[model samples]
Target: MAAGNDTRITEPTAAAGRRGVLLGAASLLAGAALPFRRARAQDAKVNMRISWWGSDDRHQRTLKMIKLWESRNPGATMAAQYGGLIGYQDKLSTEFAGRNAPDVMQIADNRESLIASGRLMLLDPYIASGQLNLADANKSVLETVKVGGKLYSIPWGLAGGCFFFDTKVFADTGVELPGLGWNWDDFAAAARKISKAAPKGMYGSADIWAPAGTRAFYPFEFFLRGRGKTAFTEAGKLNFGANELTEWLSFWDGLRREGAVPPAEVTALENGYETSPIIAGRSAMYPINSSIASSLQGLSKNKLVVGTIPSGLGSKALPATQYGAFINTSMQVYVNAATKFPKQSIEFVNMITNDPEFAKIQLMSRGVSLSSKMAALVTPDIAPIEQSMVQMVQYVQEHATPLYVPWPKAGSQIQDLMQRTHQQVAFGQASVAQAVTRFIDEAGQIME
Candidate 1:
């Protein structure tokens, strides 16, 4: 249980962590023929600046991990720089654009843009020197982060979109909890049933497609992928047209009309996890990024359990896997392309990802470990909630379609447009047809 603690992340033996890092991977930096400028000498002191955006929990744990790293290797310090996610992207964008980004960073939504900016470093050299061994990484996931046959980022872990439900609410309502392979039809029916039988103030589900259009789009992408197509292609085109988009918007509209989801007023307040309807006990189930379930569970009084996200189970000749959710947030952790200490930066990330004791400290807070070794290391005694996350990660890693395309700048604009368009439909401000047309047309404009 000590190693499995999620909230109070106690550092395991500092020596064990250090030893694992020192001896875990073979080979040293073979040469200095890399980077825009000269690489640091092998024995030179390394003081790295690592930045990431997360809640207090992530910030504190990352600091502790940094301390452990410093303690493991004397005189090599890491200065911490982090904040809430609100403007982190813009700040990082400004930093990267200025070529003053941190040595090590955890990138997410802005990954494609940053990578495309010709500022991020390719990790092929480190991998070639065996300083960063990816033999343990999930092959499908590693492929997603590669751009033009070169690596820039390493996933913190792997996760996907999934449904985390309050088992107590289902039990009290006498509605059966869904097993694996549940489809959208099954999801809506159970939701309507739960809404009808539940207490006066509560609904069956949160408006998963809430204020953020991209929030809605995650599951929509999964839903589309289940039908053997994707929302966007590698060429940056809207792969699904009005007919498909209308169906997606209208499905949510029907749920809102049936009161199966919380009203718009309630959903608008759900911009942060602390304000989630599940945490507030106003809803029974939510479609969430699978990795956050443990953190969210810590906030809830209910026995929360995760299940596969609703997919196109009714579709004949489904893809290799019926599960529609693909990996999310594994597109994290990168070395600034211009870092003078490329070797040190790669070592730090390599340790955080592949080290055994570090795996125990980190657990699946980011995502399930994509490394075969790290995955095996943490799963032995992870917290029950974390175990559920691992199971979901495993399910998606095995069955869900592999989804990664370096998004252009227009991607964010399109996602923001989705938020407004979805809100219009949810608030009864726009017809599904109108909203769909606007979204498609605006997305087209954004692309052009």
Candidate 2:
């Protein structure tokens, strides 16, 4: 099968089993295969380094954007250091501790840990000085990146949770595309049906509860938020107890038993979009954010589309979805406080985020255009896949709720616990009850 053949996967599950064999990183390094860097205009007046991890497309586009920036800026230059999830955080932390961190750092799923470093350059001064443009940016979205009334990061774009489905797989399976406001029941049913219709060894869905990289695509947290619950409080304590964990884990466990999701033995840990079960055609649906539209679609020949994640509206007693105008989009672009080129670094960030030309060049690669003006400029000319990303962002923005509570810095550790507990259950090392207790106990430790 081709890269995006949809129904039949060319690469066997055997290959995917190795993608997560090592200590993979997070969503920021989603599509990385190796660590690499490019130093542009090494002799320029101002040579600044920016560190980020992203898919191949993201890296290419970002490098292109930097190239454009340098052309116009003349003396200022860029050193783009980036790669896959492996060693990303370790390398970043090492640099920060050494007080030689990159001028601009794009912290992804595990941004809070870095933000807690207390060494990131405060962006407030730049905003106040009119060096950074925010007059047209979303106020609510901007608020998500602040800590203690100080701005530490600027969002490249905005994104919300959504399911990325292979249209070809759905067509082949004769399963209807997921309808708006679909719930857990509907999702499970569709998964089972798709599995039955798919080729042998393929599942309706990947084991979503399993570890992807080190962090991001937090289904458990998102599930709880949809039902008006928090996994952890602001102070870093487990908000809801074992009952919530039991409920969520049990559902995925049941799916594993029903062939709706991959079994533990064959469930390959998703290393990145390039190696995921969905991209390989081994699964039909994968929960992803709207921001991945371009990168993911570009890798697969199968037609891919994004939609709102399942909701509990009209069915459950609590809230329905975790749609927010500013979901994970504020992954936070931080400047190193110790950097010498504070002015240049902030300007580069402002250019990438606020400039019309860069925004159009990037499209939905980073995410939905950051400002309304950017959106208007890009929406009319965006590709079909990008259009869906934009639409998903709009839908979430319109129906967002105030119930969302931000996770603490320990959020990533808790996510690791979730993955560990999931493995225990899937491998039958521990029952759901045992996993719940362990998760709660371990998560509390992480919080404190």
Candidate 3:
């Protein structure tokens, strides 16, 4: 979609200059503001550098979207730097430290840190000016990305946790595919049954909750939240106690001992979506981020279907509409607060997020549209997998609790500690009790 008619590269207004002076370069710089002082004074073209981490599919589509934006607005040029998620944060952090960060970026794990350090440009002004249309945004979803009462980022799409299963594998093993109401106990039992029935080399599931791998804390966080607690609070403290952590570790250990999941050797080799055991046919089900359903479907030969994660069973009281999973931003887009052309950057993000045609091209590659208007506009054109993601998200929104806060600033460090602690237990380097105790101690130190 085209942005506003104000496409000209005009001089900063006298008031804008005064506001910039009031904001102070150092303050802006701390927020990772664009260091446009390095640019030659005579340069007129409004060029912006945008960065994100993603697969080739996402890279190509984002470039195409950028091209579309440029075509609609003359005199604006957007250059992109894209790569995988690993090291993306370090790269962005170094750039920000050097005052050479991109004008726009997709911030994930580093979000809380960036916001806490004043590194992200507050989108409040643009939202107030109606430059970035958030009226269609889910208020609760929008609120999750806010830091200290100001919106720092805008989510790309909506997604929740989903168990993406291979129907063919379950059929072959004579195991029934799990339904929506299945509990953790049922999940483990089905896994064992399927593992016994399958070919000798294949297991029923991957150690998706494997601590040494990607988003290792997701399942643990899910478990905690399912039990009516959270891993961390809005105050950024570790919310669950040591005893709870022990139970989480012990449960995974049980799954491992029962041969319900792939062996450590197989899980240890996991790199990402491409190297996932599901793609390699080493397992029947994979816990996906719910947004990547289309990518998983593209990679697997079996008929892939999306289902809910295990519920609380009858052990704990649940809300009348409760489901175990929660909706979260798959990723978020934000503009540099210090960009010379904040209006242009915000407009670009607005089009990418709220424009109907852009949504169709994206096709929930990120996740389902969080905007009601965009979701409705693109509904007819999305792929079946994308449709399933939207449907599953709708189900969760109506039936599940939403994560109340963005991961804390220390989230990545906490996740690392959790992964290593679990890996120690998984590899027999430490007892579950030892691992849990160590994690609690280390985590307290990190959060402190």
Candidate 4:
């Protein structure tokens, strides 16, 4: 999409600023506002701003969870601002610039810019002070949220990447279910077979816009590892060249041109399962994050099954870490650097991440719950949905390739380059080699 046409739906930051100004005016005119007077006299009540981006269902559940926290703690009140996925980062950036950022904000997976801007509160002091306990949180998830050797945020849940397939379609096509060890050649052959057997309206696969950070780049990185290379070197320099990238791009271009997958035009317009060719039964397979599987359930009239990404040709099939569902490199809640009530804010964040009841409400909203106890509670409510996600997670834990260190600064931009490169190549605007070279050049500029 064009940058100008990007619709930014922020929750009235200007209005919030106006409210703050008006409150100051009222306080000056009347000597003190009633709430301000109460706040000053009482045991220092903390009113915190909490913000995140999600759909309406997520908002409702989060609000309910916050209400429960409020009921338990009478002295604290949290004001919330929520938006959809598309414009969240832009809105958050605006709020941060205005110094009107929430006391607690959900940082995205690729949030190096936010970290670099020093907008987030470091949680190390809180953790070291014994005010926050992260003993139960996954170590990998914790590592992802850490920057400059200090924990800046805590993951709300785990997310994994996997391919969603129509089980019946595969069965009817006489294609065996994909196993953890299946290689790319196996996948290609299956796609061809499935394409032949698929009905007129259905194709073998739907192409997703390559993810811009851990979500998109990590999976392909995993694939590259099987070919004996990494995207970047130990010193965080681009290690692979145009030749390798051209091969990867060529694979997907071939798929598109061969009619195994829909064209980029069809895929680009689809933002989610409701509009996704796979969920609409126009394709037999789609690779997506596990969190979205729940949303896909209702959208798909057929039985949807989760599977691993295919391994490289001839190499030992390395199980790629289920990129989306694992807790590492996930969305996190961080305290604001300027909050007056840091302790209460941390408690509130703890309430959302550590509290079982509240965490249950966050089920599949962020991904699967990170807390095992909360996962137990939420899974029972959404048994079938949760089961599929759990199976994928377990498969990755047992069978996937070894996990790598989380990417550092400029990680997000690198992924963005990859996605745009894929689009350029898939649309035939550039050859695979040209696309790869362009990506490297653009990524280098961002890294510098």
**Regions more than 4 Å wrong, model 1:** 1-44, 211-214, 315-323, 402-404
Candidate achieving the largest TM-score: 3
Q: Candidate 3: where is the Cα deviation over 4 Å?
A: 1-39, 210-214, 315-322
| Consecutive 10-residue window with the lowest summed lDDT within model 4 | 317-326
Task: State in Å the error of residue 46, model 2.
Answer: 1.4
If both were scored by lDDT, which would come out higher, candidate 3 or candidate 4?
Answer: 3
User: Which candidate, 1 or 2, would have the higher lDDT against the true structure?
Assistant: 1
lDDT of 2 by residue, 314-398 (tens): 4342235453223656345788888888888988888877898898788877788668888888888778887877777777666
lDDT of 2 at 137: 83
TM-scores of all candidate predictions against the true structure:
0.85, 0.84, 0.86, 0.81
State the lDDT of candidate 3 residue by residue for 1-448, as single tens digits: 1333333323346667778897896686686644555456668789999999877777788888888888888888999999987788789888888888899998657677777777778888888888889888888777656777788888888876677888899999889988766777777888888888888767877785532233667766766777677678888898888777877777778888888887677777778777888888888878767767777788887888877766654433222123456676657888876777887888888987789778877867788787889989988887777776787777766766655555788898898887788678888899998898898889889988
Better of 3 and 4 by TM-score: 3
C-alpha lDDT score of every prediction, in listed order: 0.77, 0.74, 0.77, 0.69
Better of 1 and 4 by TM-score: 1
Better of 2 and 4 by lDDT: 2
Q: Which stretches of candidate 2 lie over 4 Å from their true place?
A: 1-44, 213-217, 315-326
TM-score sort, best first: 3, 1, 2, 4
